[model samples]
Target: MPISDFRKKKLLYVFNVFFDVNQSGTIEKKDFELAIEKICTLRGWTPNNPKYAETHETMIKIWDGLRQRADANKDGQVSVDEWCSMWDDYAQNPDRALEWQSRYMNFMFDLEDASNDGSIDVDEFTTVCSCYGLQATECKTAFNKMSKGKEVVSRDEFQELWKQFFSSEDASTPGNFIFGKTNF
Candidate 1:
């Protein structure tokens, strides 16, 4: 689905608030690197782990995706102006964003779907949710809610939840629990 103008504007604000980890007035490489590190630490995904290489690679790919899509000046960072401009451009020409966003979501789903079973179970959900510093019990409950007793989440369902997570205003939405606080 294409991002609507309101959603695009909202997302621009959300990105700046959430991703400017350094609070340096810009989204820089250091900020991204720090975020990746914090995620790995929170998840206890370390270099010594068997899945470390794959996890590290995915993080790198995510950073690259951000830079490739928005680092307008090629300065390895995204200023507020650059970030807003990028989203404004995307809002006018949303087709391009759809492709990139779809690819990113697919890549994330594939990475977390370790069994390649076309769906994600509790374990898979835990793996993805770990980065958010969520407790196992909390994640399990959230997964149950999102799964609605199916005990597995299909790709389409996950995509819908992803969108909901980003755009929904309702505080109690199931997708809101998939990661950290959505209200912020």
Candidate 2:
């Protein structure tokens, strides 16, 4: 499914964090140098901590994959043009994209899954949405619908719902609850 520019821009900005690490408005190899520490913090891990070795490794893999795809020229860096074009990074490989999408969702889950129970409750969901600067209450209805009375969202639920949120034209798809505002 084709993604809207608005959403693409939003997601792009998220990706931009890695490339624009120095906030210079462009992606360079140096930007990735700080990724390990940042990714550790994002995953609630401490750098040089062995307990998080696995998670940290996965994060590195993800970053490596992004760099490989975005740095198309193999010139050791990805400029804004190359970074924005990252939308097509996996366009030719839906299965691979799906796998990456699962990891993306896992990262989101890790961010919001404070309980570490492998699911997101209303409070947890609200907290994650709040981080995006959206009003927490605004997503209650959508969360309710997505949770379907389950009161929590599992990994499978989040991944599938997120995919829909990324591509589904259906207004009722649970993906809309992701940010609490799907008007875009």
Candidate 3:
């Protein structure tokens, strides 16, 4: 099935607000590189650090995957239309969606687990969202909703929420807030 308007908007919000780090109107390698730098900077990882090198490799791999999968025109960038269309395909094949989205989900959860406690507390979620330019209050609210009254979100719970974020069409679903305010 085709993605709903709300789903399209949410995907676009993710693309424009988060992944398009360079504000280049499309997602390109530079966006991933910039995101790597920002994330590494936030994590205090220096070039000599193994984690920094790992981050660079991981982000580049993700960029290559996205470019190969979503860049239908082979222009080396993913535009909003291509993004939504790729997601539409995913929507039609949920198993494939889960498989493809798992890597990103794990990366995000691990990144958000700043304390390395194997779970994401509200403060950690808030901090990550804040880094993405979301309001602290909004991040707190989103964490509360996504966590569903739990003190922290476990990896399993986060996996479920990640699936919902991509698959659920309902606007009121808690998973919709997984990335903070969706604006739709």
Per lDDT, the best of the predicted structures is 3
Q: 25-49 in candidate 1: lDDT tens per residue?
A: 8877677677667655655778788
TM-score of each: 0.59, 0.65, 0.94
Candidate 3 TM-score over all chains jointly: 0.94
**lDDT by residue (tens digit), candidate 2, 1-184:** 4555755654555555424666777666455556555555655677567736766566656666666667788876666667546655443443456444566567777766879998888888776565444677765665787777688888878877666555544666666566555344
Model 1, position 174, has a per-residue lDDT of 66
Error of 2 at 159 (Å): 0.9
Where in model 1 is the C-alpha error above 4 Å? 1-27, 30-61, 72-75, 79-96, 180-184
Better of 2 and 3 by TM-score: 3
Residue-level error in angstroms, candidate 3, position 47: 1.1
By lDDT, the better pick of 1 and 3 is: 3
Sort order, TM-score high to low: 3, 2, 1
**How are the candidates ranked when ordered by lDDT, highest leading?**
3, 1, 2
Which residue pairs clash in candidate 3? none
